[model samples]
Every structure is written in structure tokens, then in C-alpha cells.
Target: MTVILLAGGLGSRMYPLTRIVPKPMVPLAGKPILEHIVDYLNTRGFKEIVIAARYLGEQIVRYFSNHPHAKPVLLDSKDTADAVRLLGNYIRDHFIVAMGDVICNADYSEIYGYHLSANPAATIALKQVENPLPYGVVYLDENMDVALFVEKPVSLEAYLLSLAYYRRRSTSAYENLVNAGIYVFNPYVLEVLERNPGLMDFGRHVFPYLVENGFKVKGYVLSHRVYWSDIGRIDTYKSVMWDLLDGKIAGIKPPATEVSPGVYIHPSSDVRGEIRPPVYIGREVRVKEGAVVGPYAVLEDGVVVEEGSRMVESIVWHGTIVGRDSVIYDSIVMNNVKISRETRVYSSIIGTRRIVSGELRNSIMEPVEVVSPYAQSA
Candidate 1:
């Protein structure tokens, strides 16, 4: 089956980092989140993959092309409906389509199986989250069919978010299944998508149409216990990386990137330094000595933690530099960033190329918005 991965979001919440790479390419557990996603799909014998991208779409295409495994396809477009419709038109059979930005350990085998067995126009992978307001919530029927759909309700009450909890919601109200951004679609559904290219999301658009227009759409609540975190924000990115750095979750078995006696780097990396361990680094990276890299932190590849700089509990991404003697703690440095000497950073996301000198105290260094006790960006 072919899988269409939606990787088109601007990743506004994951700026700087997203500024350099698509969210699907974001680092997670010492590997690109997309890699993990692909690995999962590959394990299921699904080799043909399509990534629907917009921002930095070529990067995703390039990264996959260089590395051989599953042959991945990239589509850079603004319309999700058109992407899916095109994909559906190409694959004239039942197929899987998933989110390109999902950061989870969910397995698609069962979800895919139920979809085929039920033979519906579409089969949605769902979960009911405690706070259903921020997600595409749904209600399921007794026959495991979706009866209602709600896209991100702003309710504070716990909605018990899980594909399983949909047992109650899908049977009771508006959204029967909480969308997990995974779906199985039959070729017959292509006309629906083709007719409605303006639809924002599959859950919000196509599924509702199917339900209202007498289309058979079902829900398969995945019964697996896996760690899934959406790393679309600085906080989430930091948390997911920390879990990998600390061995908190077992998602994809990451490629070996460790070199030094104690350091643990990603397989897709290049480093030239005597680094210490308890560190997590991303793919296609570089590192230099006197850089005192990590005891409990990470350095995403293409990242340059220059001499005399010390990074702890911080995530520095591609094309970034932490200058000499600069101390960074509990911070996230985005791509294309530059940090000067003797600077102190903590608890913030430093945007791309924010010049720094002196000391910074709890700040999100935006584009050219320096935080050091020095002159500002011109």
C-alpha cells in the first residue's frame, strides 16, 4: 500500500528549526522524525511513500533520496485535499495515508487491517485525548463507524484522548473518533477529494462529506501502547529529544551515531571532537573541539558548537554556532543561529542568526533579536 505523508505545515510553532527543515525532518530520538515514520511504514511492507510538503520540501526529498530504503515521493503544494486526491488517483486500490508530522510510536498494521476488512470508503486512525479541544475529535458508533467529527474543540475538560476512548465518544456524540492523523482510503474516495480540493483537512473535510453523503467511513482504534509526542513546538521538541537523550522511550531503533567513548551521535553525522556522552545529536551534522559538547544535551547536525562553548539540556540545530565560552542551558537554538563569546543562555528558543555577546537571561532570541548585554541586531 502507498502512504501519503502530510509534511506541508509551515511549522510556525517550530520556527528556526522548521525554518531550516520541514517538521517531518525534525530530529527526534537522535533521528529525523520522518525516518522513524518511514521505518514504521517500511516494516509493514509499505515501500511507496509520498510526502506532501511546502516549506523546505526539497530538503525532505533530498534527505530521502540520498538514503536508500523505501522510495519516497515529495509533493510541494498548499492544498492537502489535492495532494490526497492526486495520490488516490494514482494508487487505484486501498492505501494508507498518514500525517508527516506525527511523532508517535503507533503501529499501522492493525489500523490498516481493519480498514481493509471493513472495506469502507475510508478508515480513520483515532484516539481520544484528555484535552480534545486541540485535536480533530470524533465520535464513533457501536459498529466502530464514525458518527461525528469535531476539529479541535477549545474545552478544558479531559476528553480522555486515546484511540480506545473513542469507544464512548464515537458512540455518543459529534466526533466518534479522535483523529490520529492516520487513514486508509479506497480508490473510490478519490472523486470526493477531487471534487473538494478546498478542504483544509481530511478529518475536517472528506470524512464529514462521506458521513453526510452516504459514504462508508469507519474508525479503527489502535490498541497499542506507544509513546507519541507532536514536536511542533519548542517545548515539545525539547521534551521528545530529552526522552531520547535519556532513553525514556523506545520508538525507532536509531542508527548508531556514537563515536567517542561516551558520546552518542546519530548515524547520519560527521563530528571532529573529543565529546562526552549522555548526549544526543541529529543527522548530517558536524562538531569541533574545545566545544565541550554535552553531558546531558544534544547538538543537531549541521550545528556548530564552537570552541569553549558548553551546552547543557539544550538542543542546537542545523547551521547554528555556539561561540567560545558561551554557556547555554535549558535552551533551544534554531538553525542558522550564531552565538558569540561569554554569553549565558537559559530556558528559551534562540531563533536563527540572532547575534549575541555578553550575557542573556531567559529569552527567546528572535531573528536578529539579540539578548546579550550588548548591541542589538541592526
Candidate 2:
């Protein structure tokens, strides 16, 4: 079975960090997010995989070459559906489609088997999240078929009123079952996509069209043990990082060796500081004497923590240097950043390769490319 991974989005929400790197290339647990997905798919017995990428897709292509199991399809268009539509010829009868930015613990083998047995035109993986306003809520009938799809209503009250007016009012009970950005679809669904050239997203267009046209679209509720999250926003990214360190997220292991109880230090690093548990120090990292790191800190490869500095609940990226007497707490420092001595950084997202010398708290510091007002829109 072929797996289609959509990685073509601009990822404006994760800007500055994603200004030079694509969303899939964003690091999670010391590896690219897409690498974990590929590892997950490989373990599930799915061999052939194709990635549809645009908007700095070259980084992805360069990172993973044309291997037998993994192939890259650099698209001219940025639309998700268009990327999938371009690969329609490669898909034989059925295919697995997933968003690149999402990380989930759903069992692909079981989901694929369920789809094959039910023989539906499309099968969407659904998960019940606390907040349904930000997602497209799916209403499943008694037979587990998709009865209706609501694409993120402006207000929850409006959605409830519309739901109360529907013929199958009881379907509101399943309002929390939002789309998980994962799907198993037959060639017929792709045919439906081909008919509408402007259709761009599965939740916004394809899934709704399938239900409206009387096509059978089923929903598969994931098991409770499964974990799912979208690392699109800065807060979510930081949360996911801490989750990984705390062992809250399964199947994502940091590449560092556990030196002490919860302290993981890479073999190539030079450390002489005090490192608390639940810390991950990557390769070639330098921790000078009198520096205190840890209790949820991650220093990626080539990072330098100078003397008398303290870091806690922070993620410092590759090649970044923290000077003497500096303190960082509850923050995310992007790649190649340099912090001068006596600086204090907390609760912020510092962009790639920036130089910081002052005390910044409860603020966002993005790179030059993401500082302009038009950067978010672009």
C-alpha cells in the first residue's frame, strides 16, 4: 500500500522557526517530525511512501533522497489536494493520506484493515478532542457513517443551533469527533477530487463532497491509548517538546543517552556543569563549569552553555551559545542563536540565528524575515 504524506503547507503559524525550514523539518525529540512519521509507517508494514511537498520542499528532498521505500514529489502547486491529485496515478486502488504536521499514535494496520472490510469510498480517522471549535466536527450515524461535517463554525452556539435543526438531531452527541487529518481512501475518492479542480483540502472540500454526493464515508474512532497533537503553533510545539521529555508521548525517543536517572547526555558532548534529570543534551554540546542545566531543558547539537548560567524548561537549538551568567526558563531558542552574558530569556520563541544581549520575558523575538507585518500573511 502506498502512503501519501502531505507536507506542502506554508506553516505561517509556525513562522520564524519555519521561515527557513519547512514544517516537516521542524525538530521534535531531536529529529525531524516527518522522520518520526516515516518510522511509524515503516514499523506498521507499509513500505512504499511518497511525500508531496512545496514551500521549501527542497530541504525535505535533500534530507531524504530517492530511496526505495521513500520518494519525494516536489509539487509546483502548494494546495494539499493538488499534491494528492498529482500522485493519483501512483495510487492503485487504495492509499493512506496523512497531514505532515500532525503526530499521532493511531495503529495504521488496524485502521487500514477496518477500511478494507467496510469497503467505503473514504475512511477518516476521528479523535475526540476537548476543543471542537478549531476543527471540523464529524457527525456519525448509527452505522458509523458520516452524517454531516461542520467546517469550524464561527461560534459554538451557532453550530449547536444548526445541529438541533438537523433531521438527525441526536448526531450532536458525536460533535467532539473532529477530523484527525488522517484518512484511507479508494481511487473513487481521488476521482471525485479530480472532478473539482479548485478543491484544496480534505476537511474543507473532499470529505464534505463525499458525504453530500451520497458516497459512503466512514469514521474510525481511535483507541484511548493513542496520542495525537498538531505542532503548528509555538505553544503547542513547546508543549510537545516537554511532553517528549517527560515521557508523556510514546514512540518518540530522544537520541541522547541517559547518563543519570532522567538526565540524557549525548556521547559527543563536553559537560562539566550540574545537569538535573529530565534533560537532553545533544551531540557536540558544551556545558562550561558552574552552569546549571535541566529539569526539562534540551540543548541540541553544538550548543554552548557558559559558566554560571542556568537553564530550565527550555529548548535551545543547534549551534546556539548561551553566555556566562545567562538564565533561560520556559522558552524556545531556535537554531544558531547567540545569547550574550548576563541575559535572561523566559517565555518566548526566539527565531533562527538571532543574537540576544538583553533581558526579554513574555515576548516573541522572531528573525528579520518574520519581523515585518506582511510576514504572517505570506
Candidate 3:
């Protein structure tokens, strides 16, 4: 079966970072998040992958130009459902549609099998989360069919209604199962889309239409052990990074080699400083003498940590230079950044190609100008 990876959202929540790179292109461990998703799908025996991209999609196209299986399809549609409608030519059979920004260790084969047996028009993947207000809350019937789908019940009345329904069903309030953004659809669903041209988003329009119109839409709940996250916000992005490093996420490996227990360092890196465990140092990374890295740190390829600097619980992306005596804790420094000496970056995000000096805490620093190769070519 073919898989359609949606990578076209504006990603407004991720702001400056998304300005240079799309949400799906954001690096986690060493590869792009989309790459990891593709790898995961490949491992699950799904070789036919189509990435539907827009909003700086050329980068995605260029990235996957040499890839054997994953292909990028640039679309002009403004919404998720529209993107799928535009790609209707590619849907010849039952297909899987997944959000590009979501990463999970979900069993796609199992979901496919369930969909086949249930034989619903669509099977929406569901997962229980602590907070359901930020996602599409799904209420399943006794037969596992979707009874009601509420996309972000932020209103008080909506919350009360959901609470009442859960109470009637004897389900715990905290046990809120949300739409995991993975769907299996029958080809007939495209006919429904053709009839409703204005149906833009699956969450906002498509699923609700099906449920209200008496179409069979089932919910497949993921197992508790399955790890999944949508890297849409800064906090979730950081949390996912930490989870991947801590080995909570399975079936994906860090790009570097584990030199010691919990310490992964690439062979090309030149390390002369003190490195605590639970850290990853990538290719061509240089950790100078007297610097203390880790306890939870990720230095991507070509990064340089100068002498006397301390980086703990931080991620420094490609080609960034941490100046002498600087302290970076709980921060994300994007690619090619240069931090001056004696700088303190705590709980902050430094965007690409920036030059930083002084104390930056609880802030977001974006570059005055972005000189990207994509921009140049465009």
C-alpha cells in the first residue's frame, strides 16, 4: 500500500525555525523528522512513499531527489483535504495518510489489518494523551466506531458536552483519546471528497462530515507502550528530542555511534573535553579542552564547543560555535550560530546563522536575515 506523508502546513507555531526549514525538515538526532518517519515506514514494509509538500517544499523535493522510495509531490492546495484531493490520481487502492510532523512507533501493519477486518470507510488512529484540548478528541462507540469527533474543544460548552458524554459512557476524564493524525482510507472516500470541494482539513471538515453523514469511521487506539508525538511546538520539540535520546522511542537510532554507555559520539568528532553520559556528538564536532558537555546534550555535525564552556541539557545544531566560558543549558541553538565568549544561553532558542553575545534567557533569537540556499535558488 502507498503512504501519503503530509508535509505542507505553514507551521506558524514553530515560527523562526520554520521560516528557514519546514516543520517536517526539522532535525531530530541527525536526520530530518520526515526522514525518520520515512525510515520507520520503510521498516514496516511500506516502500511506496509519497511526500505531499508545500510551503518551502522545494527543499523537500531536493532532499528526496536521490531517495530510492520516498518521492516528493509539490502541491498548491491550501489545506490537508485539498492536498489529498489534488493527489487523487495516486490513490488506486486502500491508502494510508499520515501527518509529516508526527513521529510514532505505531504498528502500521496492525492498523491496516484492523481496517481490513472492520472494513470501515476510514480508520482513524487514536492515542490517549494527558491533554486533549490541543488535539481532536475522539469518542468511540461500543463497536469502536467513531461516535463524535471534536477538534480542540476549547470552549466551555464543548468541554462540558465531552465531559457529559464520557461520564455517560463511564470513561475516565483523564483517559482522553485524541486523533493521532494517521488514517487509512478506502478509495471511495475520494468520491466523497469530489462531492465536497470545500472540505479542506480532515480534522476540521472531512472526518466530521463522514461521522455526521452516516459513513463508517472507526477509531484504532494505539497501545500504551507505543511512543508518539507531534513536534508542532517548541516544548514538544524539545521533549521529543529528549525522549529519542533517552531511548524511549524504539525503531530509530541516533546517527552517531555509542562510544560509552549513554554517550554517543561520531568517529570523526575531535573531543578533548569532559563529556558526561547521555550525550551525542556528531561528525566533525570539536569539543575543546576544559568544556563540560552533557548529562543530556546533542552536538550536531560541525559544531564546535570552545574551551571552558558548559552545555547541559541542550541541543546545538550543525556548524554552531560555542565560544569560550559560555554556558548553555536547556536551549536549542540552530545551525551555523556563533555565540560570543562569556555568553549565557538558558532556556532559549537561537535561530540559524545568528551571532549571539551576552545573556539570553527565556527568549527566541531569530536572524535579521536568512541566507538560505533554497532562497537563493528560488
Candidate 4:
């Protein structure tokens, strides 16, 4: 079956990082998030894949140019439904749709089988979250049919009112099942799209329309053990990285060799410093003497950590250099950045290809030619 991977959003939430590359292009483990998704889909036996991308989409095109089955389609639309509507010709029959930013190890084969068995107009994959306010909350009946859908309840009163409506009908309301941003739809859904020309989003528009118009919409609730995260923000991105290192995610593994219990280092890497567990040192990395790296650190390919430096709970992308005596705590230093001597980075995100020469705390350093605003004496 053909799967449409929607990846066209501008990703304004990720800011400078998304400015450099699309959200799907964001590196995770040792490859882009999109690559992981594609590889997983390939393993699941998906033959044809179309990637809908814009806003630095050429990078995605270039990356997948030689691929046999996966192809990139550049579109100018900003909305999810619109992207699919533009590719309506590609939808020959029943198809699967997934968001590009989400990282999920869901069983697509099982979801497809469930969809075919239920015979609904559309089937939505749902996952329970502790806090449903940030996501599109879904209310399902006893038969696993969607009763109501609310896209990111704006206020507590609104959420409570929706919960109340669900509580009156079924006790399932207690389970906070939110939209997982993956769906299987029948071909007639294309007719619905054509009927509503202005429909732009699936959560805010399409799903609700399908439920209210008496079309059968099924809900496939994932098990509690399943892992799913839309890495839309900085903290979630960092947390997902930690989860990958901890082996919390199934069907995905770090692209490195395990030297010790939880320490993964590439064969070409040179390490003279001390390394704690749960760390990943990538290709050609160099950790100079007296440096301490670990306990949730991912130093990507070609990264150099100088002597006396310490990095904890941080991710330094490919080709970045950490100067001597520097400290990186709970931060993400993007690709090719240069951290000067004795610098301190705490809970911040340093953008790509920049020179950091100061102390940054709880801030986001944009990708600009000028040095960081917090520059100070080492």
C-alpha cells in the first residue's frame, strides 16, 4: 500500500534548527528522523512511499533521489489535508497517512488489518497521554468508534466539558486517548475532501467532519508499552534522544558499537578521556584526556571534545568542536558548531555552524554570523 508522509510544515516551533533543516531532517541517533521512519516502514513491508515536503525540501529530495521506492514530492501548501488533496491522484485505493514529525514504532500491518476488518471510512491510531491538553483529544464509544474529537482544547473548561460529555456515555473517557497523527482511510474520503475544498487539517477539520457526518470512524488504541512522540519542541527532542539511548524505544537501535555496558562508540573514534554509561560516541570522534563524557550524552560523527571538558545530558552533532575546560549540561549543540575554551552551556540549544564563546543558560542560540550574546571571559 502507498503511504503519504506529510512533512511540509515550516516547523516554526523548532525555530533556528528547523530553519537550517526541515523537521523530518532533524538528526536522531545517527540519521535523520525521516530516515528512521522510512527504514521502519521498509521493514514493515511498505513498498511505495511519497514524502510531501516544503521549506528546504530540496534537501529531502537530494537524500532520497537514489531510493527505489521512496520519492519526495515538493508542495507549497502549509496544511496537512491540503498536502494530501494535492496528491489525490496518488491515492488509488485505501492508503495510510502519517505525520513526519512523529516518531512511533507502531505496527502498521496490524493497524491496516484492523482497518480492513472494521471497514470504517477512516481509522485513527490513538495513544494515551498523561496530559491531553497539548494534543487532539479523542473520545471513543464502547465499540471503539469515535464519538467526538477536540483539537487541543483551548481551556480547562473546554476540556472538562468534553470529558463530561464522554463520561456521561462511557467510562472510557477516563483513558486519555489522544490522536497519534497516523490514519488509514478509504478512497471515498477523497470525495469528502473534494466536497470541502477549504479543509486544511485532519485533526481540526477532516476527522471531525467524518464523525459528525455519520461516517464510520474507528479508533485503534495503542498499548501502554508502545512508544510515540512528536518531537515538536526542544525538550521533547532531547527526551526522545535519551529514550533511544536507554533502549526504551522498540525496533530502533543506536548506530554505534557497544564498547561497555551502555557505552556505544564507533570503531574509528579515539577516546583518551573517561566515559560514563549510556553514552554514544560516533564516527571519528575524539575525546581528549581528562574529559568526562556520558550519562546521556550523544557525540555525533567527527565531534572533538578537548581536554578537561565535561559534557552531561547533551547532544553534540556532527563535526562540532568542544574546546578545553568547557562544560555542556542539558544542551544541544547543533552540527559543525565551535565552542571556545572554558565556555559553559546549560539547558540551551546552540544552532548550527556558529561559534559559541560564552555562558548560555535556558536560551536558544540562533544560527547567525555574530557570536552569542552571552559572550564573556573564559
Best by lDDT: 3
lDDT of 4 by residue, 1-378 (tens): 889999888888877678677888887877778888888899889979999988778778877777888888989875999889888888898999998889899999999999999899999999988987777778888788998876655687877777767657664543788899899999889989988988889999999888988999999998888899998987788888888888888987788888787788999999999999789898889999999998899998889999999999999887899999999999988887999999999999898778998788998887754221112100
TM-score of each: 0.80, 0.92, 0.94, 0.93
Error of 3 at 282 (Å): 1.6
Clash pairs, model 3 backbone: none
> After best superposition, candidate 3 residue 204: deviation in angstroms?
1.2
The TM-score of predicted model 4 comes to: 0.93
Total backbone clashes of candidate 1, pairs 3 or more residues apart or in separate chains: 31
Cα lDDT tens digits for candidate 2, 1-378:
989998888889987678877888787756778878887788778888998889888777877675557888888864777788888878997889998888887888889999999999999999988776677678888889988887767778887666555525644345578788889998787778788888887788878888988999998998768889888888888787777777776766677887776677889999999988788888889999999998889888789999999999888877789999999999888877789999999888888768998899987786644321112212
> Model 2: what TM-score?
0.92
Query: Ranking under TM-score, best-scoring first?
Result: 3, 4, 2, 1
lDDT per residue, candidate 1, 221-283, as tens digits? Answer: 754466666666777777777666665555455455555543677776766655656787766
1-378 in candidate 3: lDDT tens per residue? 889999999889988778788889887887789999999999889999999999888889988887888989999987999999999988899999999999899999999989988889999999998877777678887778888766655586777677667647743332588889999998899999999998999998999999999999988999889999999998888888888888889997788887787788899999999999788898889999999999889898889999999999998878789999999999999888999999999999998888999999899988555543233222
Separately for all candidates shown, the number of backbone clashes (residues 3 or more apart, or on different chains) is 31, 0, 0, 0
- Model 2 stretches astray by more than 4 angstroms: 66-68, 154-157, 163-168, 171-175, 368-378
Which stretch of 10 consecutive residues in model 4 shows the poorest summed lDDT? 369-378
lDDT of all predictions, in order shown?
A: 0.68, 0.82, 0.87, 0.86
